[model samples]
Target: MTQWLVLAAAIAVEVFATLGLRASEGFRKKAWIAPVVLGYLASFYGLWLTLRLGMPVGIAYGVWTACGVALVAVIARYVFRDPLTWKMIIGIGLIVAGVLTIELAGVVH
Candidate 1:
């Protein structure tokens, strides 16, 4: 339970960092740099905690990346006016499915 919460935090921070990256605009915006860097660092620390708490690396990484990617894409669509076309939506769906498969596979082992 604690591990899952840690993983969730990890994913949230990663999404925050990614959105920060967009805000940074290739680092042209100096103000966004600090938040982006800190968010990424905190995200990595959360991931470490989840692993140390006995979450399998495969599952941890899968869920972290999948959720991060999905959240970032959806949020960016609104916040950054990024495109969220059907093709991209399908790709995101496949990514989610793949992560679920990897997690279930790890559990069976």
Candidate 2:
């Protein structure tokens, strides 16, 4: 349970760092750098802790990235007025399905 919590936190932090990346304007903005860097640092630390807690690397990465991608897409649409086309929505669905498949496989094994 604690490992899953850490993984969730890592995903959230990674999403924030990605948003910070956009706000950084290709690293041109100074103010966004701190959050971007710190968020990434914290995210990786959380990921490391999750792994140390015995989560499989493949499953951890798959779940982390899939959730991050979906969350970022939704958040970016609202925050940056980024387009969320049907194609992107479909892609997110596929990613989610793939993650679920991987997770279920792990459980079955």
Candidate 3:
């Protein structure tokens, strides 16, 4: 249970870090860099803990990437004023479906 929580936290942190990167504008600004760095550090550490809990690396990674991308897209549209076109929603839906398939498949290979 804690492992799953950690993975969730890691994904959220990673999303924030990615958003911070966009705001950082190539790390020229100080405000954005700090959160980006800390967020990534915390995310990586959380992932490490998840692995220690016997989570398969590939499965954990696939979940992380898919969820992160989807969440980021949604947040971008709402928080960053990005357009939420049908195409974007469809893309995100596909990503979610793919991730669900992978989770259901259960084997990495």
lDDT of 1: 0.95
Per-model TM values vs. the true structure: 0.97, 0.97, 0.88
What would the per-residue lDDT of candidate 2 be over residues 1-109, giving only the tens digit for each residue? 9999999999999999999998788999999999999999999999999999999987899999999999999999999999999999999999999999999999888
Candidate 2 ranges beyond 4 A from true positions: none
Residue pairs whose backbone atoms clash in candidate 2: none
Clashes of each: 0, 0, 0
lDDT for position 101 in model 1: 97
Cα-lDDT of candidate 3: 0.87
Write down the worst ten-residue block by lDDT for model 2.
55-64
CA RMSD (A), model 1: 0.7
Comparison by TM-score, 1 against 3, better one = 1
As a TM-score, model 2 comes out at 0.97
Clashes of 1: 0
How well is each residue in 19-109 modelled by candidate 3, as lDDT tens digits?
8887787998889988999999999998898999988786688889888988888888877887888998899889888877877787545
